[model samples]
Target: MMLSAQNLTLARGGVPVIAGLDFTLAAGQALILRGPNGAGKTTLLRTIAGLQAPVSGTISGADDAIAYAGHADGIKAMLSVRENLQFWAQVFGGGAIDAALDAYALHPLADRLAGTLSAGQKRRLGLSRLLVTGCPVWVLDEPTVSLDVDAVAMFAAAVRAHLASGGAALIATHIDLSIDAEVLDIKPFRAKPVHFSGASDEAFL
Candidate 1:
């Protein structure tokens, strides 16, 4: 699943953030999107995920080939951690819940409701949702937010393994994640007056 953005112009409320942005990623290649806060990194990620349509240009790739994880932890606070995984597993048809839970070290919190979890714990639960998605292109926004050193390292290792298995990712982060990826600076294509909405992340799914 190759992702290509050509002459991509992203905007909010009719204001352009980034224009003439072009990028392509073949399998096994990771592209890291680095920029300061409010630099339209999230907007670019949203556009790529088809959650937001570009003001101009086009984002073309395999259908149902994308899996996105935004900065917000898309967990139901009322539900237990394992319940959340079960929901996503059904959403993507099926997946190994126990495996993903163990991978993110969320087993201990599996029976606990997400509302009772800390910031880092919630983030781990959020990331575990990725394993339930059946997609080759990963569009992750601020993937390491609220994560500790070990979690961050685990996140990177997981990404590395995904890439090694011919999976591609478009990751946005303010801090360095230390993955072997091509860096993309969105400053050159920042959309002015960007007002993003309908971005509950899952609603777009």
Candidate 2:
């Protein structure tokens, strides 16, 4: 298994969000998390990426092997597209910036300042960082936000190529990504409140 979670639980700000969840991802596979807003999808992805700890349970096969991208683009606005990619490539232990630029169709924007790109173009630049990371697993949250139809298609193709090379991905998004993936609805695991209707405060001493 490239990544596996067993009896996992997660919380945000002292409120339980997901509980007793289990899932597994292997090489060349994609798992799409489907849920409404406030459904803990982002939390789950964050936990798997090791940005935060799970409230309970265990996760295996994710140590030092994940590249995570959240809602924020994380790109420096003043840097050119190629400069941004080059910086990340070095930070992630070096990679082919040319390939990453080509992967996200960023060649034309390579010399353009990141601050000047449109929202969709900036999103594509943000995503190109994943390629430079060279990790086997990708943990993404709302990765396609602000992308046009053609850009979405480009991202889908990039994912397909990644999987073909024995990589895996875990994505959380509400929109259709146009890729073959196992869908996981996270609603069933959402936490429910415990009620104490009509019970006295000292009933149990």
Steric collisions counted per model = 8, 0
lDDT per residue as tens, model 2, 56-170: 9999999989999999998999999999999999998976798888888899889999999999999999998999998999999999999999888888888999999999999
Candidate 1 Cα errors over 4 Å, as ranges: 191-205
Q: After aligning candidate 1 to the native by TM-score, how far in Å is the CA of 196 from where it should be?
A: 23
lDDT by residue (tens digit), candidate 1, 1-205: 3999889888766567677899999999999898777777888888888888887887788468988999788999999999999999899898679878878888888899999999999999898888777678899988898999999987888888789988999998766778888899877766555445777655758
Model 2: colliding residue pairs: none
CA error at residue 80 for candidate 2, angstroms: 1.0
Q: What is the TM-score of each candidate against the true structure?
A: 0.88, 0.93
Lowest lDDT 10-residue stretch of candidate 2: 193-202
- Candidate 2 vs. true structure, TM-score: 0.93
In order, candidate lDDTs are 0.85, 0.92
Q: Who wins the lDDT comparison?
A: 2
